[model samples]
Target chain A: MEPIIIEGTPKTPTIKFDSSKGEFEIKGRSIPENSVEFYKPLVDWLDLYKESPLNKTVVNIRLEYFNTSSSKCILDVFKKLEAIHKAKNDVEVNWYYEEDDEDMLEAGEDYESIIRVPFKMIEIVE
Target chain B: MSFNVESYFSDISSGNPIHFYKGNIDSDLINKVLDTVEGKLIKGNEHSKLRKKVYNVLVESLQNLYHHVDKVPDDFEDQTSDKFGILEVIKEENGYRIITGNFVQADNVEKLEEKIKRINRSSHEEITELYKFILNHQRISSKGGGGLGLVDIARKTGNRLEYQFKKYNEESSFFYLNIFVSENY
Candidate 1:
């Protein structure tokens, strides 16, 4: 499958998903007005990726700030990955938050609670 | 409509007006508002946490206005009726206040008021639970609103949602929301 590589903007995140390498990353701020429109393609790609099996799938989320709309969409993205993990595949989520950002940390924890995937809360020191 | 729109605008126009806008609210305007406000917060040397909190809440507030604002009264002047709304950022001694004004259909007022009151009355833990429940169960609306914006705003600010509804006419009313971003937490 072809990789999904999109650059980040002030209102969106950088998305780099490589199926061959089994690594996916989303970084930066996500406060788009229409989050569903922005995230629809990625969610669709994940659906397709779930069809093929990978030895291990690693996902990284490094978001400084995301609006409530983006928050819901982010959860949707995680739910898709959770399905992949539940299918007996090796899926790991690395959630990165800045040091002293309790909100972002809690956000990661929120997803961890809802999704059935293991999450590593990595704190980035500024 | 007993609500004096002119006086309300004049009343909030006081204080250190960091930024004020009254017109059509589109995606472009939302980006500009976020950029300008984030720049001001950075220049003011606000703590990163507080800055992010304010940015997060502000994004929700502005997007709410963009999606929920109703049409302007036909007789009303200054016709920017396409998603017409008012936004004011004031610098108080204690913290920054983000005030947004928009028109709402009279029929929808009761539901919206009850929603705000419920949020204002919920404890932090309760709000968190409510947020989680909705995130897990609620379907995203056609407008891309998951009914989580208000709840998320309250959770982030740790403050009650202050609001007012001024009767504009039998068909519509002016709704104002005052959200404070304090340095205390």
Candidate 2:
């Protein structure tokens, strides 16, 4: 599968998924006009990647902020990864939050508590 | 019997007093407002994290207006048409004040009131725990059109939610919410 790269904006995040290296990254803001439209392709890519089953899949999320719709899409992404992890694939999610952003750190914890996949919360110093 | 167009234009355009866009609020307009606010913040050399918080709150508030407000006209093309919401960022002595106002139906006021009260009553740590608890146990309820959005706003602001409601009619209310993130604070 070809890699997907999206530009980031004040209201949208950049999505870079490398199918070969199994490194998926979503960064910046995420308040897209239509969350479903912005995330559909990325979700589809994840679905396709699940079939090939990379030795290790690392999903990195460094979102400064996102809207409620984006939150739902993030949950969907995690649920998809959890499914892949359950199938005995190497899947891991590294959720990075700013050192002082306790809110984002808690959000990571929220996702961790719900999903069955391995989620590591890392604090990035700015 | 003549209209004073020049005077009206002069009064509206003078000094850039944080103009309010009142008619239909759409994604394009919202993006414009977000850009304006962000530009001002960056020009002022404000903290990057606080700017992010303000931007997030702006989007969530506008989305609430777009999806839930009932005053929107049927033919309004913009996502936030007739939504009757305001997003204003005023330069204060310290930093800036971000304000958003919209309308809420009467039936949904009680739930909103309860949620805000609960959030305002809790400490930051408690609110964090509550956010996780809700995320885990409570399925996103489609009631009021913005289930977790409000919670996310409260969480981002890091302060007790401040709100006021004015009786618009027998069945609806005007909701006003204000959040302040001081550059020094």
- Candidate 2 accuracy as TM-score: 0.80
* C-alpha TM-scores of all predictions: 0.96, 0.80
Best by lDDT: 1
Candidate 1 versus the native: TM-score?
0.96
Chain A TM-score for model 1, please?
Answer: 0.98
**Candidate 2 lDDT, B24-138, residue by residue in tens:** 6677887888788778778878677666676677777777777666562233233455556666565656545556666677888998899889888888778767766665555
Q: What is the C-alpha lDDT of each candidate?
A: 0.88, 0.72
Q: What are the DockQ scores of the candidates, in order? A: 0.80, 0.42
The docking category that best describes candidate 2 is acceptable
Weakest ten-residue segment in model 2 chain A by summed lDDT:
A32-41
Residue pairs whose backbone atoms clash in candidate 2: none
* Clashes within 3 Å, all models in order: 0, 0
